[model samples]
Target: MVLAAAGCSENAMYDLDGGAMDAAVVEARSLEIVGDPTVSLAGGDTADLTVQLRDPSGAPLAGETVRFALDGRAHDSTLETVTATTDAMGLAHSALQAGTVVAAFRVRASADDAASVSFDVAVGDAGFGSMQVTPEYVGERETLPRVVVGLFADADCEDDFVRRDPGDRLQVLSEDDELVRFLGLPAGVSFAVAVRAEGEGGTVLAWGCEDRIAVEALETTDVDVTFDDEPLVVDGSYQTTSVFPTTTGEDVATALEGARDALLPASDATLILDAAEATLSGAEATELRAARASGFDATYQTALESLGPAAAHEALIDRLRTELTSLTVVGRLRATEGELDFSVLRLGMGAGELEVALTELTIETSLDATLDSEELRVSELLIDLSASELVRALATREAFDRLLDGPSAWLASAASCAALPPPEEPIGCDAVCLQAACRTVLADYWTAALTVIEALDQERSTLELDGSANVADLAGDLQVDTLEGSLAGEWTGPSATSPEALEGTFSGERITPPR
Candidate 1:
């Protein structure tokens, strides 16, 4: 049987016999304009435009050809029709150049039997101008050796006015000379210029604004920009000391006196005749006898005799040191922040030996403070404590023991003392025993680590931080995956100085370990 064939519409489905089928068909449904829809340009400047085509299902329609047409109240001879083929992503690109006359125009992109999208372009007069930027150094070699300059229509430098039409801003690289010149700017327009070094992010090294620059029809307007390069140097030091709650001076003194009384010999018969005669009178001897008969003495005399008075004093000092924590920080300021290097040391003291548990860290931080309020917000904190020296110091001390052993053992001892019944005396054997044990252990394990110091650099591994301050009060929180910690304390001294001076007492606790 022979069948008649029928032609299909542009987007209609077809059968094998070339007959129009009733099946559903997909067609281009939308045209989207990409890039900047509104552009400002000086006469003779050209800008690229893009259009995107999509099917009824919102999927890109590729391999399609799109034609562009320009429309305006008064058209220039340079405005001409152009065509571009859509790529795999359905994007078609075309270029438009402004004419010598200043006017506003619209460009439309259309596909065969598809919706069209339009973009607006504004053209200014053919007049042109130039700007000359000169660096005025406040001190010797004040300016950076290399910098990039950006000219904007607004004072914020957020909008690039010099190159508003097509290409990047006119960024002149300042080399041997201090003057950088930008040419071909839209004449008679006010502009704000900002100078900054590469890799500085958005920090502005220098900035200025030219209110107005007059450019006659064919003549060039020359504008001069002078920027002062002033170097700001800020350096300071801060110190802090902290005494543990359970190991205060008053507690230690009472413990020592109780220990002495407990160790005294009891009866005249049991006392060493010669030793007692030399150290105590008859009345004192009777009192010592009374103290021994009472239950207050337990191993006190044996400990005193075995360790000796000097060793006992040394042990006490060592114990006290272990309970004390201190921190010292020094920093040099740059821009809005400062680079700080700090060390926290837990001191252990003995008769003839001294030991320390040390941790060294470096951080970049900024201080935000005002005279009106006592609160100071500390921000932009980047910390690093991964130097080999820091590792070695930590390895030699008990500061990191919390990571391995969990909560400190001293805390447990303190809890045990708290559980005991209140004694008639301020201090008793339970507290004294724990303090003595801590002293003995520290003395036995005392060893010094070789100190190694190195300059701080940003390339090293660093952690972020958040903190706050109030006049003499300060607190900081460390943020890191493997380590969690905090620094809190009070400080005193001059608020603002060349090298801002600070004296304070600080305490820190490690919540986690790197391992």
Candidate 2:
């Protein structure tokens, strides 16, 4: 997220080389401040300073780093230093210690552009005095709040347990060395908190614990502290790499370099991913859960329409079923009565654009289809033409071309039915032979027509064709009315799936061919 001001210096904003952006990137900017030199400070105590970071516009700057300094000194062993990192929320905190202190901060642009911000702050005890030590680590059931947790820490109360009042209070409690102050917590947890020492004990003034807490089943008692007199007590306060039962610290660190054999390859582990698309809904999730068993992949695509014919169509379906049964989610666990479903809500390509994109073969089609898993129920499907290109395709076959060459060739070849019994021919072998020859000649036509009909009847989906009434009966040189019940003019699928044979009737006049 970038913050910008309406009127700020042109140099206020510059692009960062690579950063995590909260939203779209339109501008990059930061804030700068300069304070009057009158700020005062006290010795041996800390104060507070605040800096505003904003974008090129007067708007507050976010994600800036403000280093703290007094005089021209840096974090050398000879000098002390304080620093603050700006947060996404655009706030920075500076610690002021006792003594004559002047506060200032500088921001340097990251790898992207050369941009920077610098500000000066005057320091003094002219501010509030308090110190609060907060636990840095919080796990399940952890009560330490991240907000303003250290706002009221008392600087003087060493060896004190910081407590937040039930009603707007935070204070260091029990700094007396005689009694140890600690917060009582439950079992099975770890915590990271700071403990201070006020007494004149050792050369080491006071120190804070490390980040993060890792506790086994806790003894379920209060947090305790120990002195350098018996430094072994600090061992109870923190866990080392050599935690009792786990491999020693050295072993685990070595494990990162493959020195230890405990690590497993990513592919060897069983992974069950619970994935859901953003467009999917709760109902879809429920349906997906049903498919949880086995290796089903629930997805929807309209590509099935590209399957050319029965042989290819069946083969594609078989592959889909096989793949579905082989995949698994949730580590091979199966759900009974699952529904591996897909929806047609996605784009429909079978109509036109999709057909062109799918294959090299030009599918002269008028088929529009809708199918579900239960049955190949179709809303509409049709075939358009059995014209030249089509006839050649079918007719190229050695034995069956005539049957595929459109209804004209079909009618001509089968017209032997028109012949009547020859008078006086019954007694002769020639007469008997004529009937047999006609049957033999038309045998292929009957087989061809029956094959087409059976396929249409058994097809689970619809197939519409645009067969025009212009097909000419060559023998008579006349165009017959379009085949009525047989639906020669176009393809159609079952009207109701329950009775698969009942299909929509296809009728047409001598329609003009498409341009």
Which candidate should be chosen as best, given lDDT against the real structure?
1
Give lDDT tens digits, candidate 2, residues 402-490. Answer: 33443323332333322423323121212233334333323433344334333333322332422211122111212221222222222
Model 1, span 1-515: residue lDDT tens: 00111122334432211123233322435667787665557777788888888888888889999988764321452443388899999998887877766544456677765545555555666455556665443322233433444454323334454322211232334244556554445455455555443212323333343433344444444555554432222223333232212222223334444444333223211222223323444665565545546733453434334332233334433444453222223222222234433333333212111123233333333343221112224443333322223223323333244342211222223223223232244222233433444333323222111111121112112323344433321111111111112333222112312211123332322232212
Q: Judged by TM-score, which candidate is best?
A: 1
lDDT of each: 0.39, 0.26
The lowest-lDDT stretch of 10 consecutive residues in candidate 2 is 234-243
Global CA lDDT of candidate 1, please? 0.39
